[model samples]
Target: MIELGVLFGLLAAAVLALIFVLLRRGNGSTENADGLLVEQARRLQAHNDRVSYNAASVRSSSPTTTDHYRP
Candidate 1:
């Protein structure tokens, strides 16, 4: 019974150690992180551009309060 408990503790410790080692190995370089930032900036700029275009289209096609209430 004592040996079984010791074995289970060692197994849990080894699994935790393996997880820590893998996470440490996955720490990437500055270049990869910078590339991610640049990609996000590009996506944001494209979204802004699309929103601007749609806003202009809606402004042109939709009527104003004055137009709606005009005699």
Candidate 2:
């Protein structure tokens, strides 16, 4: 029972130390992150436009009528 208590106390102390270290670490600038996000958005928009254009072209070029059913 005493050994188990000592083990839990040591584990708790380690966890607290880790938390303290993480909290002490300062957050860096967001300028680079913002730039990256903006670039990603632009690329995504371009990809979407290309996809839309391809779909439109395929839809227009494909046959609309079925040979088995004639009106």
Candidate 3:
């Protein structure tokens, strides 16, 4: 009877350890995904800013039809 009790205790401890490790791994993966998304968003915003700046510069430097249509 004493041997049976020791076996059950060991089994329970092993199962608990496995569950803890799996849960920790699942959380780590979620954090990694979140970090990747944040990095991508930062890069997208930088690209958009550059494009907007270029467009504004082009508009300011180009001549308009109004310049030639005045009486």
Candidate 4:
């Protein structure tokens, strides 16, 4: 039973080490990171603009408070 526990502990440690190395290797350069962030920001802005335009259109098409009160 003790040997089994030790084996599992070593396996877990090896997995953690692999994960750490892969993460470090995948980080890439700062310029690439900056570009990715900029692209993400642009996409976010476009999404926000589209949502705002759609919300405005919906608001314009809907009935007004005065119309509701009259009805």
Scored by lDDT, the top model is 1
Please list the Cα RMSD from the true structure of every candidate, rounded to 1 decimal place: 9.0, 8.4, 16.1, 6.7
- Collision count of model 1: 0
Please write out the lDDT profile of model 4 over residues 1-60, one tens digit for every residue.
999999999999999999999988895666557788998999999998887777347566
lDDT, candidates in the order shown? 0.80, 0.80, 0.78, 0.80
Pick out the ten consecutive residues of candidate 3 with the lowest summed lDDT: 61-70
Between candidates 1 and 3, the lDDT winner: 1
Q: For candidate 2, write residues 1-71 as lDDT tens digits.
A: 99999999999999999999998886755656887799899999999888777744656543554444457
- Name the regions of candidate 1 deviating beyond 4 angstroms: 27-71
Off by over 4 Å in 4: 27-71
Top-TM-score structure, candidate number? 2
Pick by TM-score: 2 or 4, better one: 2
TM-score of each: 0.38, 0.40, 0.38, 0.38
State the local distance difference test value for candidate 4.
Answer: 0.80
List of clashing residue pairs for candidate 2:
none
lDDT of 4 at 70: 48
- The superposed Cα distance between candidate 3 and the true structure at residue 29, in angstroms, equals 4.4
